[model samples]
Target: MKKNTIVTTDTIAAISTAQGEGAIGIVRLSGNKAYQIFREIFSPSKPIKKYQSHRLYQGSVMNGANTSSLDQVMIAFMKAGKTYTGEEMVEIYTHGGSNVINSVLQRVLKAGARLADRGEFTRRAFLNGKMDLLQAEAVLDLIRADTDAARVQAIKQISGVLSEFISSIKKKLVQVKTNIEVLIDFPEEEASPKQLFDLKFILQAAHDEVMHVLKSYDQAKIIREGVHVVLIGRPNAGKSSLFNAIVGENRAIVTPHPGTTRDYIEEAINYKGVKLVFTDTAGIRSSEEPIEKLGMEMTRSRVEKSDIVIIVTDPSAASRYDEELSIAKEHKDNVIIAINKVDIASKDQIEQAKNAFEDYSVFPVSAKTREGVESLVQGISGPSLAPSIENAPVINRYRHKQALEHIELSLNAAINLIDQQAFPEIVAEEVDSALAGLKELTGEVTSQDILDKIFAEFCIGK
Candidate 1:
């Protein structure tokens, strides 16, 4: 960015309300010329000639040319340093309509403020230091959150969970930095075998802490967004029925014939504060039909890529599941054997399924009747689930994970160097690398292009 272009061309204005009819619509403004334009035409309900920051007044928005009253409204003024952006701000809360609110915004624009760029308001907030980079990312997550679990994770980030974690790592990094400086500055006095041995202890503890956080990342990632569960099995195995039951909606078609669901159907659900992205993929089988073959190949891909795989099987055709169950056992870290159509099966047939898939966690449930179905969800992610994600590190974005991974590698390298009694200079390089990652996470050492990319994803009036 050019030095001259840093502050933007002029004062800006925008319609903050979602474009539609509502009880109220807000026209927001920010910049040096904000109040000057307001004073020229606003006829305050009381004390019309003067205004103060944060004071609300009843008023009528008028076109300066004709003095025509556009709408009845209440205006709220915010002083610099106290508003969303650290600039003078004005909000005109008019009765909502496409015509009146937009007309009022245009009038403000004519008075001199330009229309706001996408996320410019919040961008200004970041420029003014009201919030850090992580919190700004949370703003988007909170807006697009599909489940309560996602919202909760976003709120944790906004409330500084990630910040605190970064701080903890930074504290360790600071100690490592101090040790390196001590060795470099006074090699004769400070660089001794005893000092090196103590430094090893410090590096080991820091490395362990990083590993602990890394171990919990899987749980955190799932809770922050949702676990991707892909259902793949032979057709007529009640796969769609299981999806509908779990989603509590008829999200997928179910019929007595094979290959009824030709593609995948997705649905979101919060299973006790843990969101689940349940997908019903096409049945995995060879077919003469091109679309079905493509779908079957896609199902295989989804099953391989997903965090969890659920294979639905019918008790009547339990013979096919012997091989399927073996595969599930091989990938036991994320596999659930779901035996559907239990309502139609006899007690002996249900028992046979349980015995056949003994190596995997098999659940016998009737998705059509919603009987014993809730248990399957509860087992994977629910209140009764053994592991809880309370205070889990909220690293949902790939950028954050990459940064943390750098920290992990650097810290581990430092630990190895310390163990091997490698030179302090080599250890210092690893420390510096770790510090760079932590700084990037808080955006202390980030490039303008990255910041632009981050904020550019936001909508206008953020």
Candidate 2:
């Protein structure tokens, strides 16, 4: 369908609750004929001779022919222009149960209502001027938020903080573009030096705004998708012990024998309202055993995907994990050196371990005694826990990031043309391209395929 196409011609119905037992289940309908279709199957306790908007009545849902009741329900009606979809809507509140909800839904379908597609309700809201693309995307983010920090970012996006910021930038660009077009329309007029300077200034400001939003995608990604942390070290380096301590459980088996852990163990924990998924991989070693070799390969793959690598070191075998240390050093920003078993290590042994990895920040920790474990967790999530993040506009999706890049590119081209003293018409062309990028970001410029991919991410009945 086209971006502006209104989708309220046919009434749509769906079970708006989870597919299990609960306190209540809601069956929602929206379209021009919603009230008419709902009245066909719902019988009110007191006669509802006249249809009223925003009124609830006790009723029972009946079969298509209105002969037998299927379930007890309380039905509500909302007239057009004030509903979620900006069309007539009705909602049926029935007892929570799969059978009861399905039966009532079947009756509604049989009474000329079609089952709703995934995210059709919210899509309608966007098409009806209720919310923009940014807010619509936030609904899914809010639903899938795994931590308090992620929830805060999602709520800010949904509240139009990012949208309003982008709007302000776009409004300034529009004014600049209009003045340039006016100059182009009258070729006899030579643009003044002051006009050229002002144009350059506006373009630079827009470019800076786009770059500012782009800078936050990395931090937002960590909040939206939890950070992946992997514990890697040589055999019997206390990798398993540190993993268990961090997760607050004995999730991995502890053993004195080297190569006891032949596979990787994964667990997630919320640290300072941010999520950290820790994985305990097989200890890195020069083992020729087939199982140990295969486990090492998997460990390498996990390390490549992980956002943080905790290279645990045992003071007794200080020089044994040089190969693992080399690997961690390759990703300097993502590596955290942890000296485990510090409770038993002597002063010389601790000094030797720290000196071995002097290039990296090393933390002396004892997983068994829980010493310095909290500091390790904090070190793993560097800069993300800063309080300044609360006030920044976070771009949580790749879609938004790409749109900002487009705007930046367009503004750069326009600014270059202004510097070269190019024709006003050519400069206006670049401005128009930048304006289109903003429109696409806010759903003003979109296609059917784009709409389908975005809404498909949402759960049904949203």
User: TM-score for all predictions?
Assistant: 0.87, 0.89
Off by over 4 Å in 1: 1-12, 110-118, 146-149, 186-190, 326-330, 383-394
Candidate 2: regions farther than 4 A off: 1-3, 64-67, 252-266, 282-301, 343-347, 386-392
In the range 82-186, model 2's lDDT, one tens digit per residue, is 777777889999999999999999988898899999999888888877778888899888888888888888888888888888788889999998899889888
Q: List per-prediction Cα lDDT, in the order shown.
A: 0.79, 0.86
In candidate 2 the C-alpha lDDT for residue 54 amounts to 94
Best by TM-score: 2
* Residue 412, candidate 2: alpha-carbon lDDT: 96
RMSD of 2: 3.0
Residue pairs clashing in model 2 are: none
* Candidate 2 residue-wise lDDT at 261: 90
Q: In candidate 1, how many Å is residue 208 off?
A: 3.3
Write down the TM-score for model 2.
0.89
